[model samples]
Target: MALKPKDIALRAASALVLAPAAVLAIWAGGFWFTGLIVLGGIMLALEWARMSEPQDWRAVGMAVAAGVIAPVIAAHIGQMSLAFVLLVFGAAIAGLVSNRRGGEGLDGAYGVLYLGWPCILLVWMRDLNADQGLYWTVLVFAVAWAADILAYLVGSAVGGPKLWPRFSPNKTWSGFIGGLLAGMIAGGVMAAWLDMGALTAFWGAVLGLLAALATMGGDLWESALKRRFGVKDAGNLIPGHGGLLDRVDGLMFAVIVVAIGRLIVLMIGGNA
Candidate 1:
């Protein structure tokens, strides 16, 4: 379905306003912003959990555990080792506790990883470096947005072969390629503008492509969870954006991936 001109305008306008607001919030919002994200994670996690364990209170407990603890864990951004331990142990304990909920075992296991793990990564990425912290955050999301937005617009305009029929039937190979190119172009341009190192620029292109795919995986992953749960969307948070999960799906995957990459770079002493 085509996005009406008015819809496009509204989306752009909201994005224009909200994007800067979001940045500023992240910039100054500090740990509370991390807490706010954890709140969103809880909502999304609970929604996913309720799918297979509709009658379970343990699932709710797991969401609560995640909401409270994930932020505490996230607050240890510079302390990667401690944060990583918390995430792993938290997911494990949450998963074990959730098993009493019956068919929700797999659901709980995945939900914790889906909602909580990425949050850890996001915080870690935030504390990666001094000079380019905000720049990197903006680039990661910007590239992901380029991939998603372009794919939707171009795919709707020029439909083609399905990219993944089982998970996302409407996704097209052509659309995927278009999104990749658009993201690469955005990443490349941003890298040039930012005067990032050669390796950083290369990482931007490589990570941009990988993050796009991961972001798509996130969308399909959430869609699968929702389908099993017999829900339309995770929540009605955004007017046209479906829900918090729908909005942050890309971020959920991309952030962790960014975290891992940054961690590796740090382990080896990154250039900048």
Candidate 2:
């Protein structure tokens, strides 16, 4: 029996609600968040390698190192500016050297950028002020969820212009607009609740929308990879979603952009 859309939606929404609370709770304890994020980074690394051609172990090692180090640096680094420069340099060098042949080079390049680095920003966001950081963590997650759900719902009903006909046939431009609007609303509400500034609203709305758009991009990006690799789904990890990569692709892009945005803001004293 094929599950009804409503049923699938209900389960997804439930999971979204419960999962982050669990994560936030776990993260509050000493080293729990760090440990969990590292574990996720490793798992995501392994999954990405399996998805790519000729599974590069060096890439896997890079992911492992990133998983362990980036979060720790973000959590404890005294000078975030210098530390971030070094982290980016390390990731670039690792991506440059992770693989020798095959299309896996391109895959390896984006995979580290996609999988390993942005997570550092998320960790920094999580540790911004413990109390404040928790909300930031939850906000990013919630914003992504809101955009995805809204896009799906509106996309189904309206079914207007396709966002990208080549990559994702099912995605409609209507869904894109819906996601942007939904993200804006979600970000606004979170900003008000958190007492964040107008600039937070700016990044939140812009980044939130970009996150939603990139979420679709991430979906299609993996879809293209799997199709090229002659596989169905990234892996059998998630129930409905293909794999952790499939689930996180959008958030991955979103966080990276948001992290860069944050870095820029911090550099220019925009946070104040």
Candidate 3:
């Protein structure tokens, strides 16, 4: 179904406000960026808990909150390895608490990883290369945002066969293609702007394509979660977007892809 003009306006307005703030945080790259990640992670945890176990939402939320916060703090302090370990430990704690309280232990555990890993990775990635970290972070955001915006616009205008009727009935093949192209173009442009070599630009485009695929996967996964919970939106935190989780779902996955890709390049003695 096409969004009403009012809905579109709301989305645009929200993006106008949020995008700049996010970009500014990314540029700041220290306490500001870490703070944003922490806040978003906490909100996501609460939302997940609310959806998964409304009756025991507080307990689950607190558990997930601890899980997300500890790792974020660790990552911010340059303890990447400790951050990963803390994330696992936090998830385990959350799971145990949920199981004892008669909630789904696996759901609670998954929530920590789902909402927390990206936060940790984002911080780690930002600190990976002091010189290029800003550019890389901005590139990830640009690709994800461009892909999402293009997908929505193209999908609504050129509605055709549904991409996945089960998970996301409203998504179309046209939208997916549009988003993919947008991601590639955005990544390439960012690389070129950074004055990287042509080969780097080509690799950037490839990364964008991978991120786009991951973005779609993330969106579909979130849709499946909502479907299982029988909710239309995660929460009404934003004017147009459903919640913090809804807004950052695709970006979260894209971050994971980009971070892993960077790590692989580093391990192989290649410049990322």
Candidate 4:
């Protein structure tokens, strides 16, 4: 399939707006950064709830509340474990509320956890250190961005078998391989730019591959969810992106992967 001119223009225009704002917020790496994560989480929750249980305002409310609460817990209390516990509790509440309101309880719970954890982890990643915070956050974004863009381009140019027809028919194996390569290159470049050394650059490339795979999974998951809900797009909130959730779905998953990897390394090094 060929890429549409209008789609390209819209994507470019949207990138023009979103890219600068995201880079600026990440570079700041403080309340500004946290605020952006919070906003993204809330938007994701809203989109999820609206898509999964369209008539259930209670589900939306619960998810959004959980989204807001989780990040606050992470940023203010700085207790990740406690924040996760709170998120679980919130999900339980959301599930119960949805059930009572004649909706799917599991969907409510899923929505909260799906959007909440990533937002908290993103803040946690940025708060790791004053010097390394920006580098780490930007590195993850670079991987996701590079993968998404390259995948789109390659898939359109090298049309072939779908990667997963059941979930995302548009994605192709060619796109997947191309995206992984682009992600690795982007990750290595970012690591070098940060002066993190060759070893770190190699690991960054590896992480980029892992992150790109995770991102593809994330995108597929959302596509499946939308299909389940019989929706074309999550929302029309963003000009080219469809919704904030649409834009960050892959990022949310990639952030968790990168954060977990970082945490494991920190623990092994006795810094966690």
Candidate 5:
């Protein structure tokens, strides 16, 4: 269904509060930003555990610990590789413990991997280099936000054929195109503003396009999960957005992709 007037108002109100707080935390990078990332991940873990296995303390604790610990360790020690190992170990531990709690290892492990690594990796991206880290981090946020906002607006306005009626009935092709275009533009503009050069700007636009696709994929994946589990919204944490996961589902996916891209760049000894 199209967004009602109340939905729009609530969304706007939530964004007004959240956007500024996020921007400020990001601008004050360090513990401030990492703290927020960890907190968000913990919240996601909690929601995931609750949604998947409500009242399962072992599963919930394991997920939360993994999500919170990964980013903190990565930020302090500057070891993305080690952080990754820890994340894997955490997932394994959660999985093992979950089985004892009458759940398949799959749910707990999946929840940790889903929420933990992304949180760590995004912070790692933001701390890559003192000068470039901020730009890249901001770029990810801007592109993701642009894509989400444009897609919703365009989809509501144009009312075209559904992109994937089974997964997300409200999504449309027009919205996808509009969001992709807007996200790419935002990426390119952010790159240029950061004086990243023309070549880098071009690649930024490409990254934005990929990120937009990832965003849609993430949203659809979450929706599919919700459908499979027979839940309406993740949780009513945000005013308009259903939960913390609902708000950053796209960013979680985009940052993982972006972090992987950054890792590849570093491995190749090319900074982009």
Candidate 6:
């Protein structure tokens, strides 16, 4: 269905407010960035809990909150290995708790990995290089945001065949293509402008395309999860955006891919 003017306005307004705050947090780094992420993680956990197991949402929320937060804190303190180990441990704990509470144990565990890993990776990525970290972090945000906005706009305007009606009925092939192009352009421009280490504009665009692909996959995954749980939106946290999870689903997946890619390049002695 076409979005009404009011819905579009609401989305734009929310983005206007939230995007600036997020960017400011990224620029601030350290405690500011970590705090923003922790707050977001908590909100995402609550949404996931309510969506997956409304009956015992509070219990599940607490489990997920603990699961995501500990790893984030560890990452913030420069303990990458410990952060990862804590992530696994937290997931296991969440699973056990959910199972004991008569909820989907596997889903609960998956949620932790899904939400927590990205948070850790994001923190790690921002701390990769004091000088370059800001640029890299901003690049990820820009690409994801560009792709998301363009996809929604183009998809609605050029409404055509569905991309995957099974999971997301409103998604269209046109939107996917639009998002991909936007991601590539955004990545290329950011890289060229910021001069991210040895990464060239061409390579940046390629990474952008990869991130965009991952973003779409992430979106589909969340959609499938919501469908499985029979919820329309994750939660009514944001007016038109649904929940924190709904807003950052793509970013969560893209950040993991980008972080891993950066690490691999660093290890191989490349300056990407």
Best candidate per TM-score, number?
A: 6
Tens-digit lDDT string for candidate 6 (1-272): 57467877899998988888998999988889999999999999989999987889999989999999999999999998999999999999999989999998997898899899899988887876775778889888988888888888888888899999999999999999999999999888987999577667997898898888888888888999899999999988788999888999999988987786577657765554
Q: Taking the tens digit of each residue's C-alpha lDDT, what string does model 2 give over 5-112?
A: 875676587567658755665458336665666667776776766666445654545553564366346554545665466556555654555545333455565655
Judge candidate 5 against the unseen true structure and give its global Cα lDDT, from 0 to 1: 0.78
- In terms of lDDT, the poorest run of 10 residues in model 6 is 263-272
Model 6 lDDT on a 0 to 1 scale: 0.88
Stronger candidate by lDDT (4 vs 5)? 4
Question: Candidate 3 lDDT, tens digit per residue, 107-197?
Answer: 8999999998889988887876775677778878988988888898889888889999997899999999999999999887787777432
Model 3: weakest 10-residue lDDT segment is 191-200
lDDT of 1 by residue, 1-272 (tens): 44466766766775675577567646754465566566656666665555546678545556535643554455545665666666666666666666755554555555665576666665555555544555666667777788878877777667878876766677777777878777777666666677444436767677677777777777778777667677777766565566667777766776766555555555665556
For residues 1-272, could you state the per-residue lDDT of candidate 4 as single tens digits?
67667887889899998889889999988888887777667677777778888887645665556745665556544787777778888888888877777888898887788888777787887887776667778888999998888888888888898999987888899988888898888877787778432327777788888888888778888889888989878889988678877877787788888886777656665442
lDDT of each: 0.65, 0.63, 0.87, 0.79, 0.78, 0.88
Q: Residue-pair clashes per candidate, as listed? A: 0, 2, 0, 0, 0, 0
Q: Write the number of the candidate with greater lDDT, choosing between 1 and 3.
A: 3
Q: Please list the residue runs of candidate 6 whose C-alpha ends up more than 4 Å from where it truly belongs after superposition.
A: 1-3, 268-272
Query: If both were scored by TM-score, which would come out higher, candidate 4 or candidate 6?
Result: 6
lDDT of 5 by residue, 1-272 (tens): 47477877899999998899899888888888888887777778878877777758545665556745764566546886778778778888888877778876788888888888678777887777765678778888998899988888888878778998897888899888988898888877886778542327787788788888788778889988888768878888999999888888888888876666566556655565
Considering lDDT, which of the candidate structures 1 and 4 is the better prediction for this target? 4
For candidate 6, the TM-score is: 0.97
Select the stronger candidate by lDDT from 1 and 6: 6
Order of candidate numbers by lDDT, starting with the best: 6, 3, 4, 5, 1, 2
All candidates' TM-scores? Answer: 0.82, 0.75, 0.95, 0.93, 0.92, 0.97
lDDT score at residue 249, model 5, on the 0-100 scale? 86
Candidate 5: clashing pairs of residues: none
